[model samples]
Target: MKLKFDGFILALLFFIVLAYFFPQLHRWENGEVLAWITSIGVSLIFFFYGLKLSFKQIKEGLSNWRLHVFVQLATFLLFPLLVLPFYPLISSEIQHDFWLSFFFLAALPSTVSSSVVMVSIARGNVPAAIFNASISGLIGVVITPLWMQLFVDFGQIEVLGDVYWGLVKEILIPVILGLLIQPLLGKWAARYGKPLSLFDRSIILLIVYGSFAESFDSGVFETVGVKYMVMVLVVVIILFVVIYALIYLLSKSVFKFNRADTITALFCGSKKSLTHGSVFGKFLFVNSSSAGLYFLPLMLFHAFQILVVTIIAQRYNKSFEEAEK
Candidate 1:
C-alpha cells in the first residue's frame, strides 16, 4: 500500500516557513522582479494549455454552454453570495480582517492546475475541467474587483483599470497566441504532460512564496490570535462543505450531467485560486496597512480545498475500482 502526498501543499508550507524565516528571497514592494517572472510563467502555462488542447476539444468545451455557464455561475456568483450573509460578523477590527480575507477567497478565480488534476484523478471530463478552470481566471479578472468595489472602495480607478489591462496583456495574449499555434504544437505539448505539470505547479509555488513573504515581512499575522485563526478555519471548512453540497446537487438534479462531468463541475466550481488571489491582493492592498491580511483567507481556503478535493477524488477513484471489479 502506498500513500500519495500533495507535494504542492508541502511546498506551500515550506514557502511559508521560508517567508517567515528568510523574507528576503520573495520580499519586495510587489515582489517586483518575481512578479514579472510569474507573469511570464503564467502566460507560458496557458500557452502550453493552448498547445495541448486540440481546437476540437476547445470548441467542444466552449460549446458545452450549459456546463460552462453553470460552473462559472457557481464560481463567481454562488460562492460570493454564500459568504455575503456573514458580513455582519465583521463587527470588530479583527473580524473585519477575517471578512476581507473571506470575501477575497470568495471572489477569487478557480484554480487551474489542481482543479484539472483532481478532475482527472476522479476520472471526470478533463477537457471540461480545463476549459472551466482556465476561463474562471479570465472571468475573475473582471468580476473579483467588481465584487470588492461593492463592499470597499478601492479608491483608485487607475489602479483597478491597470489590473485589467495587465491581465489582457499578460494572460489573454499568451493564451490567444497559443491557441493560434495549437495546430502546429499541440501534439508536442501533449507528449510532455508531466513536465508541463511541473511547470504549472512551480509557478504556483513561487506565487505562494512571494505572497507569504510579503505578508510575513509586514507582520501581518502579528495581530491574529489563536481564537481568530480557529474561527476562520471553521468558517472556511463550513463554506467549502456548503458550496460542495450545492454544486453536487445542482450537477445531478439540475444539470443532469453524467458522472465524469458531475465531478468536473463539482471540483471546478468549488475551487478558489490562490494565484489570482495573491495577484489581486498585491495590487488591491499594495499600499494599505492590512495588505498582508488580505490574502490570509485565500491561503487558508487553498489548503482546505486541496484536502477536501483530494479526499473526494480518492473516493471516486475507489468507486471506479469497485465498478471495474
Candidate 2:
C-alpha cells in the first residue's frame, strides 16, 4: 500500500484539526507574538522574492500594450465581476462566507512563479508573463483591499489604520530592501533554494494554523461544514475553467493575439496567488473573526487551478510539438 501526503494542504488540514480539537495548544497569550512572527515571515518571503526578481526583464515586457492591458484587466476587473452577480444567491452566513471566499479568489492577483512556469511550458510570451505575474502581486496590494472595502465596512477593522504602515513594514519595505540588496545577496538566496522553499512553506503553514486556530477558538468553522466545502470546491473548479476559457477566446478570436502572447495572457490572467492571499488576509481580516473563512476559497482555488492549468498547459505544449513534427 502506498500513501501520499500532499504536504501543505495536508499540513493545513492537520493544523486545522489540531486547532479545532485542541484549541488550547495555540490560544496562548502569546497570540501577539505569533502575529508578529507571521508578519516577519511574510516580509522575509517577499524580501527573498524581490531579491531574485530582475528589473531588466520587466522593462522588456512593457512594450506589449495589448497583452499587458488584457492581462491586468482580466485580473483586476473581469475576475471579480464574474462573482458579483451571485451576491443575490447567497443567503446564510455560511453562504456569505463562501461568497467572500469566491470573491477573495477573484480579487487576488496572478501568482508569480506558477504563472511564469505554465506560460513557459505552453511556449508563451515568457517576458510578458514574468512582467504581468510580478506586477500583479504589487498591484493586488492596493486593489484587493479597496475592492474588499466596497462591501465590508472599514470602521470595523482595527488593524486597517495600521494598514498602510503594516503594508510597508510587512510587504513593500522588505521587498524593496531585498531588491536594493539583491546584487549582493540574490545569488546566495538562489543557491540554497530548497531550504528557502522549506522556510517559505513552513511560515505559510504557521500563518494558516494561526489564522485557523483563531477561527477555531472563536467558533467560526462550526457554522460551515463538509457540504459547504464541497460547494466551494465545485465553485473553484468552475471559476478556473470559465475564466481560462473566456481569456483564451478573447485572446485568440477577438484580440487576435499570436500564439505566444495568447499563452501569456491565458496563464497570467487565469491564476490567483495564494501567497498574496495569506499575506493580504492578515491585514484585511484583522478585526473580523471570519478571517480563516476567507482563506478557504483561496486554498481551494490554488489547488484546483494548479491541477487544471497543468493539464491545459501540457496539452497546449503537445500541440505545438506535434505541429513542429
Candidate 1 positional error at 234, Å: 1.4
- Worst-scoring 10-residue span by lDDT in model 2: 1-10
Q: On residues 103-150, what C-alpha lDDT tens digit does candidate 2 reach at each position?
A: 877898899888988899888889899889988988888888878876
Best by TM-score: 2
TM-score of 2: 0.92
Clashes of each: 0, 0
lDDT by candidate, in order shown: 0.80, 0.82
Task: Score every model by TM-score.
Answer: 0.87, 0.92
How well does candidate 2 score on lDDT at residue 287?
A: 53
**Which stretches in model 2 have alpha-carbon errors above 4 Å?**
1-6, 156-160
